[model samples]
Target: MNLLSFWIAHRADMLGAIAQHLTLTLVATIAAIAIAVPLGIVATRRPRLGTALLTFANIAQTVPSLAMFGFLVALPLLGGVGARSALLVLILYALLPIMRNTVAGIQGIDRAARDAGVALGMTPQQLLLQVELPLAMPTMVAGVRVAAVVGVGAATIAAAIGAGGLGDYIFRGLSMTEPTLILAGAVPAALLALAVDASLGWLERAMTPGAARSRRVTTRAMTVGGVVLLLIVMGGYAVSGRWGSRVIVGSKNFSEQVILGELLAQVIERTTDLSVERRLNLGGTFISDQALQSGAIDAYVEYTGTALTAIFHQPVLRDHVDVLERVTAAYAATGRAVLSPLGFNNTFAILIRAADAQRLNLTTISDAAPHTPGWKAAFGYEFLEREDGYKGLVRTYGLRFAGTPHVMDLTLSYRALAGGSVDLIAGEATSGLIKGLDLYMLEDDRRYFPPYHAIPVVRTETLAAHPELRTAIERLAGRISEEAMRQMNYDVDVSRRDVTVVAREFLDTVLQSP
Candidate 1:
């Protein structure tokens, strides 16, 4: 779709996303400024404390955004899922810029200025407030500008925590390989950042004593800037829609999971009276599992293999029924239910671009194994760590890449492979991208990988609270065949169909049949 048409179609959602993005940035910036300014001042005054304080902020900056978000999720009270954790991480990410700038701004002031203020009989406080602060305003504002922009980008990651923002579109687009959708999120974010930076620049200029500008220009800047800031603050309150008496369904940040989440959500919504709150594009397994445990989400689609190995920490079993039964029994103790398998095993498969596969005459993992030493392979974070993933596969085949495999989000692996940036990737056997992108999955002739039958997992407590939900959801069991799922995925990922449409259509046709 054209930019205007896209915006028109998703105007409300975009408005809400932009609002949440702005609010996240604004709140984090304000909080960081409040804490950082004092810390910066104290550090400036006492040089010894500066080292420790700066070091602490540097350590926070060093933590990767995703890792930090995950770490914070485990923290008691202060850390959990949603906007709270997102804001806290963003504040931490934003502190260094503001704090460093604050210190530099104050330290850079001329010694003569302080001496002059003292000679004029100004108290220490008075000198700081009148002379130093005014002189340092420009530099400090620059720090705020940097922090604001940084926060904007970081806020996109907040979507992973159920803190909605433009990243939702960017991530969804990435998974579906839709550039227009990515741009829908990206263009607005860039514009928002530019708007913020320009407004802050105007404010910085206005703060400078000798900066020349017309009153009209200053007034215009102030008016536009104030409106934008106000919209952010107000929009945040509006965008965080309430979820009273609703079933929250979450999904991992990938095309398949999102489609499955929509499937479950559509089933529940259609079969029962309860509303469905979609928390799609969330972070990986841990994030979703934690959200489920904490009752932040009611249900989500999960794979038996992922639950068996990653969540339960169990050894691989060849028997599909045994694996499902074992996982279900283990989850029962935790008050979660592993529903019936969704009639497909979306097992992990090693994939290469179709042309490359054809050229090398590689038809199986073993066939490709010999050439792996010269090829660069990319894998998802979970795939890199899971026993059934890269480690075992490489061991089983005695294959090693030219260098350490590139680890990234699962969805991005498809993009990387399609772009020819990576020679091979760990992909789902049933991913629509396999057919859509003209990629070929290398056969697991050695049987290193275990079964990964898709299933719907729900909180037992939610089932009890709304007993009808059980009946509503169970209707989908053993309905989606492997071929059917791949086509559904292809429809969404390749044809660029809306997930809700695909899901709802499936539910209407399949589940409603006699």
Candidate 2:
């Protein structure tokens, strides 16, 4: 579809994302202003406190956005996969600029201006309120403008943890290898950032001592009213459609997981009265698991092999039954249950370009091992760290490459290999990109990897609360064959079909009687 047509079709989604993006940015910026402005004011008095506050803010600025998120998600109360944790991260990132500008704006004021206020019989509090703040307003606002713009960009990362925003579109497009989808998210985000910068820039200029502006609109009451209006918008967005009979279905950040997530949501909607709230694209295995266990998400699909090795941290087993059983028991111990397998074993496939495979006559992992000494490899973040991933595979094959594999997003790794950016990637066994991108999966001659049968993992308590959820979930047991899954993936990844259309068509087949 053309860009305009895509926007027309997905307008609701786009608008929703824009609202979420605005809410996240506005809320975080406001909160930062409230905290930093006071701190800035006090810093003008106590130089020691100012030094400490600046030092702490500078340290926070040094932490990587994604790394900070991962660290925060593991903490209690203030952490989780939502706006709660995302807000904290954004707030920390915004603190440095706002506070620094506050200090600079106040400290940069002339000594004569302060002495004049004191000589005019004004108290310290009155001098600050009447003279100091008015003079510093423009500079302080410049700091806020910086913070809001930065927050707009950083808020995209929040989507990885299910905090809805434009980043969802960016991540979705990347996973499916669809440029149009990426632009749908990215273009709006860029525009939003510009819009925010301009709005605040105007405010900054207006607050200047000599700048001409409407006195009524710039009054304290007007400013307070504007803040209240923003808070109201944020509150309205947060609580709307969030309650009622709903099951929040979540998925990991990949095309297949999204398709599977849609499949589960569709089935639940078809079989029950419950409304399905899709929180898909919640980053990686552990994040989804944390969401499910914490009751933040009712359910999501997982794999037996991933469950055993990645979650359980146990030894990889060849027997599918043993793997599934151990995974099931382990999940039960954590108040979750593993549902019936979805009739696919999407194990790790060592992929290389098909043309290279044919030219080198590489048919198995061992065949390519001797040629790997000069090749650079790329791997997904999870694959590099998972028990059944890069290190283990290298150890098992006794293969040595030119250097350590570069970590990459799982979806992008497919295109990277096809584009010759990297010689190798660990792809899914049932990934449509294997065929679509002309990539070949080398035979795992030694059977180093375990079976990765897809299954729905859910909170046991949720099942008790909503008994029909079990019925809806069970209807999909052993229904989706590997080929069917591959086609659904191909429809999304290669054919550029929307996930809902693909999921609804597939779910129809599953619901049909024998």
Candidate 3:
């Protein structure tokens, strides 16, 4: 579809996402300037302190973005699954460029300018303000431009913490395999970055000495200042919990989780008077679990196998019922309630292109064994390290790929497999893309895989506070089947239907049924 049509279809959501994206980038960029500029100035004045500050800032840059967000989530005041932690992480990521530029801009000055100012009986502060600052403004603006652009890109990841941004659309689009949705988020973001760089570039040029003059600089300065003020005002709305005090439904950043989350949110919104705060598009199982425990989110859908192996770190169980029981018991200790199963199992399935699968006569893990040595496998980052994931599967089948496995986002794995960049991928069994892409899921003939039953795991405190929520949520138990969910997935991913619309339609049909 064209951009105009896509915009017409998703105007409100896209606009909201763009606004949040800007709020995150601007707030973080402003904070980085507040911290880094002073640090940069201080570093230029004091060599030892500058060295220490720069080292610390460098260390912050070294931490992976998601990992840094996770680390901050565990801290006392900073720990949460919202804009607060996201803002803090973005500040850390943005520090290096701004700080380094500040130091370089000041230190780049010629010694004669400093001596001349001093000889003219100017105070140190006056020299800095009048002579040095004017000279350094161009460089400082350059640094801010880099940081601002970087902030725009990095802010996309903030959606992982329920800090809504354009990344939400991108993640949803990836899961749905809809390029339009992806572009909707991506194009705006890229444009926003260019706009920032261009506007800043104009300012940088206008601020330089001996440059041609017009009323342009003043107009541009006002334009930039107005934009910054607007973002700050929008950011205040985000931080103030303007989304409402309803039951917050959280989900991992994937298609299935998004579908499931919308299901829960829609159901609650239908059955109760309370509004639902969608903290969807959260990161991994670990992040969601932390958010739940810390009360940043009240409820989310999780799989039995993920809870068993990834969360509890226990051995894989054989029986589906036994796995559910064990997982429930484990979560109970932490004052969380694991509700009844949602009647479908979304097991991890090893997949390859249907044509490749047919050519190799591959119906099971063993059938793919002969092709393994020549094939490159791709998997999500979590799958690479999970106990019940890559290591155990490779060991069980004695399979070896042509090279090291390609670790990527689960959604990217599907795209890569489709594009023939990789020969095989680990895909979730219930994913719509499995059918849409015509990939064959190789069976675990030796029972190496465990059942991943869909279930709602809610915080005990939330239940206590609103007992009706439990009743409303549990109503969905046994409502969805494997085939039903696969069809829903297909509708969203292949047919490009909206997730909320799909969920509402399904819930409508179910509720209308005898």
Candidate 4:
């Protein structure tokens, strides 16, 4: 199905997502305007301060929004992750354009006009409010326009940190390899940007004094209409209680994660009286973990390897049972429970194109480590940057490569490796799409990578409220063997099957049989 059709099919979700996307953008834009305009005004008055403020704004823009979101997630003062961190990041992003524009707009005003105001006995404040600001409205609006558009686009990435938006569909679609799902998100987002830009443009034009009075009135009417429309959207969401659900399941951006998340939601809905709210297809492992901690998500599936390496910064292991026990014990101390592991390991391994592996005689991580200098290494965003990820592993192994390790989106990492563009990929899982690309998973003889047994991680509060949810989910835990996970992964990643279908089938087979 095309994206429009997918959105139509999932209209309820699409609407909820739209509401969330707009909320983040609007809040961030208003905050940005409030702060940026004053900062811009001050900067205009003091040229030295303006340069420093502009430099700071530029620097803030340099930090990728995703990285900024991650940084916030790690901050203790930020108190874990969720919408607040996401909002802070979005505001940071919006500031640069808004601030710069405000300064430019205020400064861009005609010098003669300012002189006229002064000659007419207007005070500095009066000159600014009546002459400068009025003349600068169009420029300021343009800046806000840029910030709003950028904010909307950046807000999509907020899904990575459990900040709901259209990004949920895009990330989920990427995980499931379904273009339709992505379209469901992308199209609406594009429409939203256009709508916002046009709305703001009209407002700016209306605010321009001496413009046709009729045009001004029309612009005012349009602005009022936009506000009313937003209110209606919010009212609808409130009535639906999208924010008040008792259970919210979230997942990292990957097919297996999505499937496991759906399985958890489905099982909970079937076996428990609590309502199920799926917030699946969130971003990286850290983001999802923070989401659970911050009360954005009640529970979600995670791998033991991630909990050990990414969360705990421990060594990866070969022994699955021992690893699970250690991780469970550790997590339990944090008021989180690692439920019974589903007997399978989806640990990270190096993947190279079949041809490249043969050429290099690389059968293991150690073998490939020395030769990494010979080929460019491409990694998924999280895997490349995390301390427990490629940086740590490469340092620990004492391996040097000639080429700089490059980071790509996780969804594209396999394709890049398979196409021979990247010689080595650091964090390949058994269910990764690279399996079908004639690539081989290098052996981790020293076992630097941890066993990634799939399991559900839940806050202690959630467990206390829904004790049976764990057992119900555990029913399908070990049912998926390593080979089964590989095949199921292929079905979604390679064969292009719907994740929901695959998850439902797995659940039916495991729960309905015997």
Q: Judged by lDDT, which candidate is best?
A: 2
Clashing pairs in 3: none
TM-score of 4: 0.83
lDDT of 4 by residue, 1-514 (tens): 4555565666776777888888889898999899999999999999999999999999999998877877888788664566788788888898988889889888888799999999999999999998999899888888898899888899988887778788888888776667877877888898889988887787677667677785768767877887886885786466334655468888888887887788888888777776777788777787788788778898998887778777887776657777788888888888888877777778777777878678878787787777766778887877875555776677767767767777777667777877767777764465647666788888877767666778888888888987877777777766878877887888888887777788878777778876
In candidate 3, how many Å is residue 298 off?
Answer: 2.5
In angstroms, give how far residue 181 of model 4 lies from its true place: 3.4
Candidate 4 at 280: error in angstroms? 3.3
TM-score, structure 1 vs. true = 0.85
Q: Which scores higher on TM-score, 3 or 4? A: 3
Sorting all predicted structures by TM-score, with the top scorer first, yields: 2, 3, 1, 4
TM-score of 2: 0.92
RMSD of each: 3.8, 2.7, 3.6, 4.0
Best by TM-score: 2
lDDT of 1: 0.86
What TM-score fits each model?
0.85, 0.92, 0.86, 0.83
Mind giving the per-residue lDDT tens digits that candidate 3 earns over 179-298? Answer: 877888889899999988887787777777777563376576768778875875566445433565667889997878889999998888888876777778788898888889888788
Q: On lDDT, who's better, 1 or 2?
A: 2
| Model 3 spans with C-alpha error above 4 angstroms | 55-81, 108-123, 126-131, 209-244, 352-376, 395-405, 412-424
Model 2: per-residue lDDT, tens digit, 405-511? 88988888898899988998899988988989999999999999999999999899989999899889999999888888888888899899989899999988779
Give Cα-based local distance difference scores for all models.
0.86, 0.88, 0.86, 0.79
Better of 2 and 4 by TM-score: 2
